[model samples]
Target: MIVCHCNSISDRDILSAVEWMRAADPQTIITPGKVYHALGKRPECGGCLSLFIGTMEKSDSLGVPAVLQNLRPRRGRFAGK
Candidate 1:
């Protein structure tokens, strides 16, 4: 299915790009922009963002690497205190 009409990006394109990125760098965080870059395209209208993200979520390689998980400090009333 076509996720981003402006960029002609498909579900497969996003999935493939995600897998390729994971293979290239297991610790790298995958984002919509990264996926677009990997496919050699850029987002245009921003209408397909939600769907694009949904498609990306379907990929097994989209999760943050184990080593990089929970590395950020919590942000709440007392997060930085």
Candidate 2:
């Protein structure tokens, strides 16, 4: 199915890109922009942003890298300033 009409990006294309990226660098963060870059295309109208993201999130290989999963900023550290 076509996810981004402007870029001619398909669901499979996105999935393949995601898998390739994950394999290439397990610690890399997967973003829509990165996926677009991996596919050798860029977003045009921005209409497909939501759908593009949804497709990426649905991929089995898509996950926050383990190294980054626990890196969220703690709220209290900066609250006492």
Candidate 3:
């Protein structure tokens, strides 16, 4: 299951990267760039973004960590700014 043709990334590779990152740092935010770096590759053309994101979303470890969750300053907090 090739997720990113430009980077030659597979679905398994993405999941492995996600799990490795989650295990390494529970608070770290996982993104496509991080995954590419973990796999020693880089994205090209941006053609695989949709599929890449789709694959990443399938992994349970892809979610934001509990400790790092809900820190965003929404409407009320932003009103003062």
Candidate 4:
């Protein structure tokens, strides 16, 4: 299924890109821009943004790296505010 008409990006393209990225770097955060770059294309119209995101969500490898997960600092943890 074609997700992005302007960029000629398909669901399969998105999935493949995601898997490749995950394999290359387990700690990498996959994004729409990266997918476009992987496919040698760029988004023209914003119409497909939602659908593009939907397709990306279907990938099993699409998740934050285990080591990098939940590294954010909690609120009010720093002193001298």
> How close is each model in CA RMSD to the real structure?
3.0, 3.7, 3.4, 4.1
Among all windows of ten consecutive residues in candidate 3, which has the lowest summed lDDT? Answer: 72-81
Tens-place lDDT per residue, model 4, 25-62, is: 88899999998988899889789999998999999999
lDDT to native, each model: 0.93, 0.91, 0.91, 0.88
Q: Which scores higher on TM-score, 1 or 2? A: 1
Q: Using lDDT as the measure, what is the rank order of every candidate, best first? A: 1, 3, 2, 4
Query: Which residue runs of candidate 3 sit more than 4 Å off their true CA positions?
Result: 73-81
What TM-score would every model get versus the actual structure?
0.87, 0.86, 0.86, 0.86
The sequence of per-residue lDDT tens digits that candidate 2 reaches over residues 10-64 is 9999999999999999989889999999999988999999999999999988988
What lDDT does model 3 reach?
0.91
lDDT of 3 at 72: 71
lDDT of 4 at 62: 91
Task: Specify the highest-lDDT model's number.
Answer: 1
Error of 2 at 62 (Å): 1.4
- Using alpha carbons, what is the TM-score of model 3? 0.86
Each candidate: how many clashes?
A: 0, 0, 0, 0
Expressed as tens digits, the lDDT of each residue in 14-55 for candidate 1 is 999999999999999999999999999988999999999999
lDDT of 3 by residue, 1-81 (tens): 998888789999999999999999988999999999999998889999988999999999999889876577567756556
What range of 10 consecutive residues in model 2 has the weakest lDDT sum?
72-81
Clashing pairs in 4: none
